[model samples]
Target: SQDQTWNDGGDFDGTNTFICEWDYEDALSASVKEFGGHSYYVFSGDCYTWEEAKRFCENRGGYLAVINNQKENDELYKLMLDFGYESAYFGYTDKEDESHWKWVSNDQSTYENFNKAEELGDVEPNGDTSENYAMFYYKYKNGAWNDGDFGFYTVNSGKAFICEWDYTNPTPYNLNDGNYTLHYTTNLGREHRSVDFDRTYDIDNIATERFTKNYQTDLAYILSVMASSAYTQGDLVYNLITLGFNDYSLFNYYDNPVDERYEEDSCAFSIAKKELSNNSTLVLITIRGSYGGFENGNLLNEHSDWYSNLTIWFPELVGFGSHQGFDAAKDKVFEQLKEELGGDLLKSNVKYMITGHSRGAGIANLLTKEMRDEGVSVYDIFNYNFACPDVAKRNFLRWNFKGKYDNIFNIGIAGDPVSILPGVPGDIISLGGHLIAQWGKYGNSYWFSDNWAEEYITYDTDLHASENYVRMLSNQKDIGNAKNWTQMQGKKVRNVGVDVIVKTTSAIPVLSGLNATITDTNGTPIAKINGNEIEYYTTDNIEINLNEYEDQTSISVNGKSDVIVEFSGIDDTNIEILVVSTSENQNKSETIAYFEAVP
Candidate 1:
């Protein structure tokens, strides 16, 4: 009854479909003209169908219609309303598909066209199951166009449409890597990988292997922690009284037959002296907490903390997985590690490294801290993934790797055990996260063997090993992966003293107050005058800022040629200039002609 003709068919009313036009004086004038106004000149009346209207408009060398943005859309709406027009038809309809309504101009939708939802229980559309098309309606509130459906037809029938166009083209991307190779190894015996050309085939396999290891380790650590209780500060008392466990022990691994918790006389460490007799080429002894034992035949004793022996007591939290714990058993282990690997570990000639996994990992990390604090050169410490509470230590390169779905990633959802320092993200590496599991060292011989010692720790090997594991500890170089890795600042690599020549057409072109300062190979400005020659030092191009002009301007240079001659006062002059090589050491300076200005 309220004119369904305007909803679908072409002929609606005297005001529904109409067009207007105006001639522009220039491009700027044309761009400034607004599309809607109450007294605008109507070029075509309400007489064309959706297709006919488009053809009619485009055939006249113009687009159907374009609403630039939201502001313009509102302006057009207001202008139509002022003209007493209800739902004046524009150049938008779902002729291509009943869904995906778009502008015929380019078949794209802008932010202005998308509709908002109505109030509660109000039958809305386009919710996952509904089609994806823009709609138009009169009395449109909450961004929904009625399309007259809720009032007259079914939910899918009465919808209107609009169109848009983008004049700019898409940008291109970088895609070059010819020097990449997969089998290349650095001087340190560490291998580098590549993902280019034919090597791209191997990338997927490498990615899959890395992903699987990280995923598996995260799953295991989460399960172990979830099945364990939050160990508190005084937990060591109960742990010691039960005799159930000692330092570096997992409660889950103990059986309660006897009340006394005894140390497991596990397999002694295997020590093979390469050439026992007359082999004194600086014996590099590495005294680390390997296999949880020592050379003195001392099996690691369980700690007083029950959380450290989580193999026995586990906690189940609803709507949460596991939590952080703060306790003192950790401190005792730190103290013992310091006493055992004291000066012997930090000797300059001794390539010693202290490392650990699980509780041992936490201890090894702390040892490095204590040694460094005592002014010892204990640079060879690498702690793999450890199941210990949060703590902070610095000046060490640590990396922490986290899995996307690892429950540990949601630690913030639970309660934080300790607050991370400023700029450190709460991820594994930030709070001491690293990818390699406690036992990952066993896979690579170079890791545990002494023959593979380098002056500095082999960063490539560390990176590869860590990348191959579940998560890596935070390191300074890993910027792309971890957030905290970005906070660190170090020496920046730079390329300086690049030489480029500028050709001038005239000799000493009108030097009215023309002046230039120069520098040498080290960017040090040079000052010297020899007879008829002036020696200027700079690899950076010399700039001549011409302020005023003087007729009898005199200038001379040694032999460098990349001098930059500029103009400010006058133009159209050519000069023969001699340049000398005071240019930076990285670049060569040559002599050339100069021009005043481009005529």
Candidate 2:
């Protein structure tokens, strides 16, 4: 073996044949070893160029070994002794900048091991720009590094090289329990908004507040209806104020400004002033979601390195930026609000609430940060977002918003995908294969775990639908009070009456022409047999018109109706009821109520 020589021509010429025996340790060959918490594999068969060798190692899920210290360099030199070769390529290079060497793995290495002096006299790595790559030279002062080129048979010829892999650091999405509180607002009713007057309410109080869940469910439904395309922008504002949102009034609406750059998708927002019972007004800013060209604009606005860079560059903005697109959209929205409300609205007594669904929700998140950074009082601001995306960079969110806003709540459905995307770009990189696992770290998230038996929870965009969110919240009840009730059916009994209630699920106000029908337990239409039909009445005891007959039965009322029924029976009977609304631009009908008939 000592008489043999591995020439640059890839020939083994000498006396006896040499046996390259490699010992085994665990899954690694003796040629493979560990140094500085990284695994390195050395190969010395076929010659390759620097680029070819780099690609060869990359295909194996690693890059050429990057030596960081004298200890590591010495270990690599000892491992090279078995190869019977003078040199091998490693991971050091100054390809980007001739003066500053860099590791192929993108890590910054401070240590260098160039030969101080050579047998020829001067030190190695003296070729300057001509030699951009480095190789470990065995004879140069006991394996010191030498600058080399990529030419074959030359100093940088594709020879044996080491591949390094890092497997020690844990993955980012390990679900470390976050320090913030988690609130499930699915069951809160709308009334809790008005009832909870004290601004001192904390997470614990919100978690345990009575009627809170039901209130939230109601509000979610209302907001979902508001997000529908059924009503015009002006009509939406009027309907919101008219439909029991008496505490709030529209401040102004900002139409998407016209700009040639944003010809595809534009942005719009509306402001509402809530007059609290405590003599203070709360400003609510609601941004509109994708409509027509705006969708294209949102998708085209590429991610920026800085939060406000794009907005600063272009007054007419269209994309979600590092600050989650607030720079383009919210900057204008904030400016409009400040101009409309004047300085008086920024007083300590004036509170602020921001809300939106989809793209609007994303804007709200960034706007919250912008307002807070501008010296706005944190305690006076409350943010409730639905199905929003990760608006800003992870570091920006962690350092700026996380643990800073106590009243902010982000509600998302378990299966919705929109709430988790624009993930670490490239397809090869994922955050533990779950977006929520990464976004959940940024704030207090309220996830609706019950996905209604959705097959693909994460990819189901239907689950992201605003209406479905409201429906799920409305149907969800406290676990302790879960039960089923009975409904009553037909048979006229003297002095016994059934009460009918009509409710509207649309954001558009319905005035009149609402109707109701009664059916038996078997779902068969029923009517009075002999002058004893169901009667329609209002809350003021005023009788309304009804067309009731045994064969053809139907009862019609105005916007809302109260009905009284007379049924003759000795045992309780179940009955079905259906209510239809004739309001324009609204859903046709819905099952209003069901009851049991008592004899």
Candidate 3:
């Protein structure tokens, strides 16, 4: 066909599969393609959301193919030309901050395979906030990439997808042998390795020093400041890395393009994590606030986009609901996070530390409450919402989940006007402060020092700007630090313990809890696990059998099942450790990590 109808990804994803076109064997056999020591499994049998596709690929022992260069893209695109697929989901998306696109594998892809609007008539990645994930070779050719919705809206679109498996060159943590690549075992007992982390730490001295070591008290403020960057289009990797997060999912809808919602703007948030010594992870999710500017004619309200902020109300019920706009915004961010992180995994085994500013702050507050409602253990989440507005019916949590969200910490400027916005003005009915419209927020509140030297705050009207907040936080070392400022207890509104850091290269299977045990087989006392921390000891006795460290200690970290992480080491040399985990139901094995530390 010379002409094909172009459908918008936001068109409700109304698609159906009349018949199954391919099967697992078909995808593996004839559709199997190889490049750069990796395998690609192509299938046109089903159309799935970007998140669904990613999870499917991982379950198949790979991930959505992350095309790195033009050659790789061309190779796959050429083969796909014979098919009738309208589009396919890949491993790339700008879900984190709309400004900077990244691979799901965090490959740091420098190659751009975008089509020119002049030639193809469609600008790549121009779908704005509604479409964050990337779809491959849609309307035009040349392996062009377009920012697409999670699901391909049309019938022909998203029917084909490719999975990439790198058993040889697994990213972030790789152990290359002289003539070959060493292997390890994991959850599924060694099917494939992982592709997260930035490799910022020296693999050799992870025991002695880790880049993700510093767990600071002021981290909440620093990350909330970084959250402001999502309001603008920029790279967040470096900043998050500095904050000790080796792996993160940055989702942004704050890009200042003509927005999709006339009454309710989209939002942005990031889910990041750092590996700790005790085989545990410290997870932080930061949400971005209103992308505002003084040029928009509102000096006082930096949530300057007047359209979305103009109307405010609870969606359904009046006295027992959240603000429609902010609530929907929170749902969008949370859904994307669950879809990306895998819902069950996020709900269990992992905890969260959340922070945000302004609109993002409001959303984060509601999000924290929702996370609790949706089975994300309350003890597993701690939120810090800054310059936040009310997002719920005030008594929403007071009567039901009282004291449940005590970990939430909401901070704001003393006289910031936005805090009271949509105030008693937006709605004509003017219900009590406990009812709705920026009234219900779930957390403790505090005011920053009011006597900030005027130099820190650039404009009296726009003190809610992310930079200004950063400045105030800079003056006050602690986010909880507040002084002489009078509390405007007006109409009220609204909003994790990591035992050990175990870096796993493979996807951890679904489990109730991680049960850890150290056996006295080889060298049980070499590395000791404390409360959420690991302490290592050195034996100067050269007579001690260094060979004993190879299979010395065994670990079992799942409460209901047997998920094992075995550790081994060398004496003042490259550490050779093999990690394994076996799945009980699947009866399969996979290698989560294979470490060869070069001294």
Candidate 4:
């Protein structure tokens, strides 16, 4: 719409010919739009302190933003300068702590490009170093607004602030994963999954003998071979093929079943010599788990980041071995140790302690026992922690502690009951006579060496006093008592030559102390028991066949009842018998490597 007065031919005629209505409302509705692919906005009200301003912006569902790029900073500078908004509080102030200026929300610096001359203004001379924070001010000299740095301030000082937000990129997926790529995402701000080893050992054996000349010279080659075989046979395939392979490759120049050259962090000789000469008072001789070493086959490259003066001595022992044949394997360890270091290693004055975590503890216990059995005089053998199915053979000055929540040794099976006991019973009382034990967390148990001299630990009088220590129980269960019981009676009972006690609250079924007779074909009492029940215990399987005499065995209880069984006189075979006392309940099945037994 137009309202006009036209002048023509040098003559001015006011309100000449055409007139139109003019709407003044359109002029008031003009919206401010940004140009050059950018926009800007200034703080609207009176200035507030940095903290107050931050809170105000946060209340508006946004944070005090930081300038991420120069272009945005330029846009902000121009907008503020042109709009006559002189000095205003920006999000750049380091109110939390100065000198370590990081954005309160998304920390990024806008003054990284500030000139040296202007940088002097960023810090106040003789001011508190801890109170360095940046602000924005319009420079009257240059007619421009620039980000300025300042120090701590009082919250009451009102200052206008601009809130900048990140609009340059798309938002990330979630808070946990963070605004980073998957490959770069950090867990706990630490690179937890980085590989520790760079060298990898690939076992290829069909090569020439000339290539492995150096491997033949390695002193530990034979031990490594034996260890590898022991690992594979013991169902520690994961260790042999993975962690063991790494350690071996680093120390030796050969692959499995083959002679070859490899690399390690340092030569074994150097490492051993350094350890022996170390002046550190307390040396920790740790049996690395089947998978504790560097991966692939590499030295610990990043250890420098941990400590400068600490020395780490890693030994490969108490390695993988079958629990079934653990004693024999332990014997080998003792024999080999004696053969290698026999008198020399034992006499070393270095104050060192041996400790193992899980399976390693089993090996440590075995070695401790073997050392004692061989009459090898030793300073002290410390058994820190052990898992289930592990029995203390010979007493040592070792401490035994296990949690009651541990379950490694309690599991059992129907076919075999003796699988869980260690080795075979011997001529002496089992150091850990209570066959069935309740272990604590992770089935870790510790038997202190003090127990040997004092019979039992003074502090451990109740045995169950410490809930952290696994509680031991005899394997023998009163069958008559157990079968008739309506409730579980797990109370520990002493076995006095067959005299038994039954729970009164439940059906009291006790084993008969008096012995009955068992006949084969004609008539005879024949039952043979082997292995030590008090000392070292080994696994045993019971096979019962009812043939001649109808497989008859009689049991007579002193106070309760007399019972007898008869096998049908089927065929002409003598009756095979299996007799288990009330105390012989346990899992005795051995693991044939890794395959779970199929029944």
Candidate 5:
């Protein structure tokens, strides 16, 4: 009964057919026109005033047409001529302001298509303040825009209207459904492997959540109180305790109080154990960097110590020896850890993670290596370090032990100079100059060179700031995968509808054999390959051609080729599409894009 046809007189009947010269269906007779990837539908037998016409289109799930360009205006004129309508109301109006016209749908009218002809001779919009509606004029002006009054005679009676619907708005893929899991992996060269833990799992979930939270807390504790000019080790411990970590209990803390002048250059370590909400225990070790003072070993000491302490020891090979200022702090940390683990306070089953920024990161790196050498399983230890300098020399980096510690991930912000360390010459020299430049200028003019001084002064201080490290890590916590070495994760999945476009940039002409495979999120092909074709599962009624969709089109100006594939019934789900291409003479297939997916 709902599908019965309606006659022209607005009567629904089972037998009579509603016919129009243009396309007609159900109760509405409409004609379609496309321009700039958008489709416009002009409905017939619907003559309503400007307000009524807008409401009619809105009820049908579209707003009145907004012609914002010459292409759209030309298409609309053709649509009107085909329908044989002299004039029809569109979406623009100035009812809100006299001359400030806007589209009724969004109130934005950046492009105006108002008529500018000599024959019309200011006859267009002549009603001025009296007219508020606009219509496409097909008679006197031959497909130009004209203004009309809302209540004036025939115009007030009703007018055919055009409605616009955008089909290109991509539907977002939902991840809440339990059927799929996002898997990500990054290729770290030299047999090193990094896999993103199924975030849905318990172990990874606890590790990531706790690491992000406690790391931020420790950073804030160091910056606000420990790095302050008036900071003392007693003040540092009190402030950390007041921060209120859940189930917090400090196991040990160490700071050397004997060196009073350099005491403010506080290199301290704290180990705390906390119970996670998921009924698991987390052992957190946080190392705090120095406070800002020349006497206290801060940036100046870190730079000088790195170059001065470079050593070439056997077995371990080239390595950076501990700085004299932080040697006491480092020795104290190991001493406390050895004592605490031997006692009944620490457990073997609890998760252990080390975190720090800048100089603290340097200490944490040393602790990780020490723990590993003591026969602690690599799987049991995790390191989340920010702006960590390269502590080990070239030969030490090539060691088997360094390659096996997959759980240690050093997060460096894009422009962080400290992360790249003494390799960044500008930062090292800048630190040196900041500490001794004034002394050279007044006390010993011969100590400084003009060229070296100029270069040091030009270093980018903003890129090496501790605050930047904190900010970058904080922003990365939500999107960065905790289990992976690189910050590539599920957030890269885009909602690009059912149709996916794979673009390849190469100089080769005409990819001969193009094939695609639908895979699960983990890169396992689900479709079976028969000869050169692969079949994907879809619903019973829907029909799709896997071969026809794989045809390539040339985008020569950009030196790229594009291939499109459509996957029906895969809506609202996550899927990986693997596309491969081969040139005419090539025997081996080339993988174009891998790990490309829709969420």
Candidate 6:
């Protein structure tokens, strides 16, 4: 029996019941080391032959590094030198023919470096049969490659090698056109929510859970996508479609997305609406935050955003003067949102929700505060925030919300610095650059750690990245409940993760499943359509034909943790399977990620 431990990534008290959620990939590349579209590593002192090192790299989800140009070659050389290695192996090798060179990662016969001198003549690969491997001799400068026995070591040598890997973000997805595209907003690249947090609490009856859980992830993923400029209003609408909402449209509502600085819409906002089956309305108002990381949006519009984030004032005297930077931003957001959301919020049949991340998260929190001050109760609005900065002075906000902050879902990640910026963590009032130095946030606080890879892919910035929050939320959506709103507080809200999926090592693109059903050969009902082209059902111990459909080539499965999958007639590497186990019992539902490598 094989037992695999899955980290729920909630809290880490370091007991046997809870372990840190990280992987070898995290250990291998959980670094600040990244460059040129790949992760870099300098293996030192692990003396191994060329073949052994090659296998080592492959075993760890990487390859012996390939230096494409002199500049990159110098960079790697410097790194190895910094590690105090006298000699190191690169990807180029000629051991097979003793003359023909090739890159170890790919069998391309391209030779770029060969040691040459003014007098020593043909300094490399001259060892013929004895020296068939190409490596760098740190002693020789001016771009030189030497072919020598990889086992040969000097006192100063660590026998190091450069290893590299590609990040799996923006992974592949299935296209209806029979081609392949990357994981975009259209394809979502997620297991359609494995847990449900869409349970709503009555605003009038505040004795129970106040905030909905699922929206923490929903808004995290959505706000992260909105952080990217690659997406547009169309993408947001498409996201709503994937979330199982219908008849979606972007409602700008006569606002210019006005901000305090450059004309660049720093406080850009939009509203989306869907009609519920009970004649109720569902509204999602999204506020765009500065894309401070690799995201294109914050970089393009950062000047205005930075100017605003640093305002850093907190005085109740300046018209609800709480954390003036965020308060000012909220005012600007309201200028754009007032026309769309300012009117009567008392239509009990309409579910009004406002969400944002980063600066936008602050705006959402403050906007909810202002609305309450304007006579709208917690019963009237659902506000969700993520990667939120300290919004207001602790006492002021704690008092402002009238001890009722459950309608405001304020989410923070464990390693995310932005969420705790402008002050220290958990400190009620901290100093900032303003007159009234007080900083804190108000809302029902929830925290999560990045579940994708256990460590940082970049620097501290990775902790604050929007994508990590989405991936983390994608893993465990029910850590807490932040759900969608409905007309009546008692109305049952549709939960997320109604659909489940099975994942593989991605030999093919991603395959997934919906909550559909059919009968198998056992006269029992097999359920769910897992992916775009191919589909499968959930049950114990099942076998199915992989090539039943000619045009439909994708594969999807719905299964339990102990389910076994056997495939026949579908041996190509391009096929993907999505499996889902939608047992009615919530506790019995486990995340099934079974992967098989195509040999």
Candidate 6 lDDT over 1-599, as tens digits, reads 25776546666676756334442223333442566777767775332356656654554457788878777777777776766676778788778876877888774435477777745446666777777777777557655777767755422433677776775321111123322111222112321121222322112122122344224444444444443211233334334443334433343211112222333324556665656656766666677665322121122233355445644434434423466656766776565555554466556676666777677788788888777777666765777677777766536536335556667777666545466454211111112122122445676655664442332211133456555555656564664443221111222212112112222343442322212344544545544333333344444543221211111222223222233344443334543343433222221122234233432
Ranking by lDDT: 3, 6, 2, 5, 4, 1
lDDT of 3 by residue, 145-237 (tens): 776675444333344677788854323212234111111111122122212223332222232232221222344445455555444322243
Per-model TM against the reference: 0.20, 0.36, 0.42, 0.23, 0.32, 0.39
In candidate 5 the C-alpha lDDT for residue 309 amounts to 24
| TM-score for predicted model 3 compared with the true structure | 0.42
Task: Look at candidate 3 and tell me the lDDT of residue 553.
Answer: 24
Task: Give the per-residue lDDT of model 1 (tens digit) for 1-599.
Answer: 47745444576678775555533111212222244331111122311124433432332234445554676567655544544444444554454565445666663546445444444333533432233323334546333332222111323222122212122221111123422211111112322221122323222222223332122322222212211111111111111111111122222111121113422311101011111122211111111111212222111234222222221111112211212121132334344444544525354432222322333333333444444446553232222222232233221223222211111111110011111111111112111112111111111010111221222211111222211221222111121232221221111211221222223444543342233444454545643323223344545343221111112233322233333433233343443232222122211122222323334
User: Residue 488 of candidate 3: its Cα lDDT?
Assistant: 35
Best by TM-score: 3
- Better structure of 3 and 6 per TM-score: 3
Query: What lDDT does each candidate get?
Result: 0.27, 0.46, 0.50, 0.28, 0.42, 0.49
Better of 2 and 5 by TM-score: 2
RMSD of each: 30.2, 29.9, 27.1, 30.2, 30.0, 26.1
Which structure is stronger by TM-score: 4 or 6?
6
lDDT of 2 at 469: 56
- Name the regions of candidate 1 deviating beyond 4 angstroms: 1-305, 308-343, 378-389, 392-479, 485-599
Better of 4 and 5 by lDDT: 5
Q: Which stretches of candidate 2 lie over 4 Å from their true place?
A: 1-235, 243-266, 294-324, 396-402, 423-442, 451-458, 476-599
| C-alpha lDDT (0 to 100) for residue 591 of candidate 4 | 14
How do these models rank on TM-score, best leading? Answer: 3, 6, 2, 5, 4, 1
Residue 535 Cα positional deviation in candidate 4, in Å, after optimal superposition: 37
lDDT of 6 at 518: 42
